[model samples]
Target: MHSAIDAATLRAYRDTHYRVRGDTPMTLRIDQPSPALAALHQVHGVDCSAFITAANPHSRRCGDDANARRQLALAQDLERMGLAAMAAAGEHPSNGWPAEPSFLVPGLSLHDARMLGEKYGQNAVVWSGADAVPRLVLLR
Candidate 1:
């Protein structure tokens, strides 16, 4: 089995690079707004206030088709900004733990993320968050 990352190491990296919002940690802030947000707003017509404020926010609550589409749009916008992305997996079939794949940017000092992706059998490192963290896309 692959060695698990130490909590301290993970905590230190997150504390230095991410902001904690409620229970979820926020990473990858958008330096500028993108047109995808506008398109999402027009298409969905739902209150995407949280997304607007957070920019390229990661949502783990995408439990339906519509929510999945919204998450994809947000992830695509982040990719357009030239940020790193990963095709995160959902729960493993054998174990209930998260099997999500992820990768850090070229210089983020988080080698553990890439290693974790490898451990989970997701070897592709791409530039779309949908590939990394969206539940619906992961199922597909």
Candidate 2:
């Protein structure tokens, strides 16, 4: 089962609490879902949807070297779904995001981050929350 959180609430929190700065890539740690891995279900959740719908400009502030990539891969495996499914569920590319989150200050590499999808066909990695529950970030 999946729960929902208001996208507006998340957006306000991001704007007031997680504003990004500079060109250095930033990392947003969104939590994974409960019970078991549920990428699709998680994406459909309110918080995840808010991030997916949020704006992304510049589109080069989010990525992962190898550790972040590997971590996300593990999460993907736990979800048991392909990139396409995740993208469809979240309404974005499954490869990853195209930029760092606008809400957070740049230069923070969160190992807990995950590559949810690629935006506009770019090699970007969307950051996830660190909480145990599922979460998403609105990166730009």
Candidate 3:
């Protein structure tokens, strides 16, 4: 029964992800790129694309809330590091791969993301599906 909306706790949760993954400069994935990431790319300088699959084609149509917010945070984190992201979109899970991230950031690995989602956790998780492994490329 986490609050899922406390800023202080949220920061701690996000920090935990970095801690477990290590702060080293590494590439990470958002499992599924969201509108926020798209906005970052369009204006904030993120280079994220969309991750499509046979089950979920037409990346736009596959857009979900959980994935979108994760992508947004990831884009924001990458922006802090001055890294550019590209939205990965395609018809195959492996088709639009943007390089295996140093750390794969997915809601499936919610031990950390969930903690980070203390203030924004949702039933619509970003990495709960069999094909949900979209991540952010933490370009070096």
Candidate 4:
């Protein structure tokens, strides 16, 4: 079964686990969600929504080649959704300088973020907090 997470919990988690950064107005990444998560979105009237992830942007684990592959994969996913997305190599707010660039999407509301997390089976959802801090919500 799915569960809910409050804002305070999310905010604390982000502060403790990730390197939070200021909002990057023009950049974001949409990671591919699992099949169950995709199905949950459809049921919730989110016909097309991208699953965002929080990761250290400065990590070199993936390298240049892997980064390109991820971009290509995300492009394909967006295409399937019939949505236009742009990919760029830049420093993202939450992730830093990711090996793979992230797809730029509009900022979402807290409500939307929660819904996305609930459906995506995410352990948590991270977004820019009111004071510009990175906030998170643990999902179980």
Error of 3 at 69 (Å): 0.3
**What is the clash count for each candidate, in the order shown?**
8, 22, 24, 3
Q: What is the lDDT of every predicted structure here?
A: 0.29, 0.30, 0.31, 0.40
RMSD of each: 16.5, 14.9, 15.5, 11.4
Q: Would you list the clashing residue pairs of candidate 1?
A: 86-132, 87-131, 87-132, 88-101, 88-131, 88-132, 89-100, 89-101
- List the pairs of residues colliding in candidate 4: 10-136, 10-137, 57-95
**Residues 53-122 of candidate 4: C-alpha lDDT, one tens digit per residue:** 3222222255666556655655664566565443333333453334324443223445655654454334
Ranking by lDDT: 4, 3, 2, 1
Candidate 1 residue-wise lDDT at 28: 32
114 Cα displacement, candidate 1 (Å): 19
Q: Which stretches of candidate 1 lie over 4 Å from their true place?
A: 1-62, 90-140
Error of 4 at 68 (Å): 0.6
Which sections of candidate 2 miss by over 4 Å?
1-33, 38-130
1-140 per-residue lDDT for model 2 (tens digits): 22143454344333332222333222223343333223322434422221221133123233445324533454444345322212211222233433332222012123322233332222223343333232443332
- Report the C-alpha lDDT of model 3 over 1-140, residue by residue, as the tens digit: 34424554233222222111232222213443344334333453323322221111212233355455555665665455444434432212333422211122322233433333332323211222233233321111
Give candidate 2's TM-score: 0.20
Model 4: how large is the Cα RMSD against the reference? 11.4
